[model samples]
Target: MTDAAARGLWITLEGGDGAGKTTQAGLLESWLRERGREVVRTREPGGTEVGTLIRDIVLHHRGDVAPRAEALLYAADRAHHVATLVRPALARGQVVVQDRYLDSSVAYQGAGRVLDAAEVRELSLWATEGALPDLTVLLDLDPAAARARLDAADKPFDRLEAEREEFHVRVREAFRALADAEPQRFLVLDASRPAADLAAAVRERVTALL
Candidate 1:
């Protein structure tokens, strides 16, 4: 098949904080490019101009933004990201490997903030104009391990990541729930595995899907 004949592939990485999504995302990008596929590496919250502003508000918040309000900001950012970046890239038949997307909002703002998943998904549809990933790579990890990685990284965990331990636990559980809800769309792997091996496994999944 011609390069342009392949449908646009939206691959998202979903997990708790510090699940090594970026590292694995980069690996997939390079791997796909080697096969002559056009790659559009992007992320939610900051993929577009307006989205970047919303990202700052969401991540570096000075105080608590109400849960639903925070969710709305994420929705706004995603709206812009999908319109300005994701849709256009997909129209060109590029492989879109994102660091995170709708699932992050559902896990963080939905479960972490104690909102409804059904409501959150509806908001996502409205904001992203109904964009959904073809496949999602879930780096399932224990909350303790994920938290330790964040703490050891020596960087501020930011507003969402700076949530209480219990909150993070909820987020992790929410993500696992999401994977269960969409088995066909998710490649859920344990995070306790070696990074290299995990990366290889993720690569194999994306390779097979493409």
Candidate 2:
């Protein structure tokens, strides 16, 4: 295939805050590198230097950010990140394993914040020029269990994570709905599974793509 036709694969990890996305991302990156593939590991809202500033305001600000404003901030970060970092790396045929994507916005802002999911997704699509991942691995977990994991980590909660259990429940349901609506694009897995097993499943699907 021509370079344009064989553009680099994009993989995104989606789940609640304590669903082990970071661990899986690290394992996936290591596995891809071991196979001699150039991998670009990144996360939304902080993937670019500009995005870092946005991330701070969105996640760390001690003020109430309107739902629409929060969504716009995330979109702005996405636009810059895709334009400057993600697109260039993909053009060089590098595998991008990202921590989150538009899906997170839909789940967090749309469902968690009680905004319109479709409108949120459309805004993101417009911002990123309709960019979508080749694969989206959804780590399904109970919000309570996820909260327990977060507690065990002993880290302060971010804006989204600091929300109520009901909000997290809504976010989880939104993620499941999105995955259901696009079975071909999503691989839904129980996050309670062993890390090795989860990694293996991810590798299996990625192997097929490679």
Candidate 3:
């Protein structure tokens, strides 16, 4: 492995909207910090200034954005995010705990938006120059349950969040397919479980990596 690849532990949490990824990322960050680990907690589509602007365009634009354009926007954010924030933090030997990553693009744009998954993934690989997480914790949840959680939150849905249930179902399936394809790199967890329990499971898996 290259020195860049060996720099630090890159961990990402992925799931459909309202799947508890943000909550778990917080817990993991706190847990790691308690153990004296220098942890960088961040998220996709808004990890940097450039990405934050791209995020609003992609998720909160008033009108329609062509599917391909949307995908490319996400790719652009990923490129900047990895180079400016993620890779540098990792190179400093910090545990980078992120709320979302490239897999989200594959699931949301590729599967949910009905684009070519392989092509979308290839675009991201080219964008980030193939930077990948050491581990990706996938919070698996049923689309209906996920929707219910979102509804309970009572917040206006973003563009992707407002997508139909069918879109979210496709996204869920895509996430599972990704986990199955690379079992060693992914830790799939049921999102319906209590948050504490899920955090414990994550802590266990992450401990092994440390």
What are the runs in model 3 whose C-alpha is more than 4 Å off? 1-6
For candidate 3, list the clashing residue pairs, or say none. Answer: none
lDDT of 2 by residue, 82-169 (tens): 9898888888889999999999999999999999999999999999999888899999999999999999999899988999999999
Candidate 1 Cα misplacement greater than 4 A, ranges: 1-5
Q: Which 10-residue window of candidate 2 scores lowest in summed lDDT?
A: 1-10
Clashes of each: 0, 0, 0
Q: What does candidate 3 score on TM?
A: 0.97
The whole-model lDDT of each prediction reads 0.86, 0.94, 0.93
Worst 10-residue lDDT window for candidate 1 reads 1-10
Clashing pairs in 2: none
Error of 3 at 121 (Å): 0.4
Put down candidate 1 lDDT per residue, 121-162, tens digits, no spaces: 889888876778888999988888888999899997789788
Model 1 residue 139 lDDT?
Answer: 94
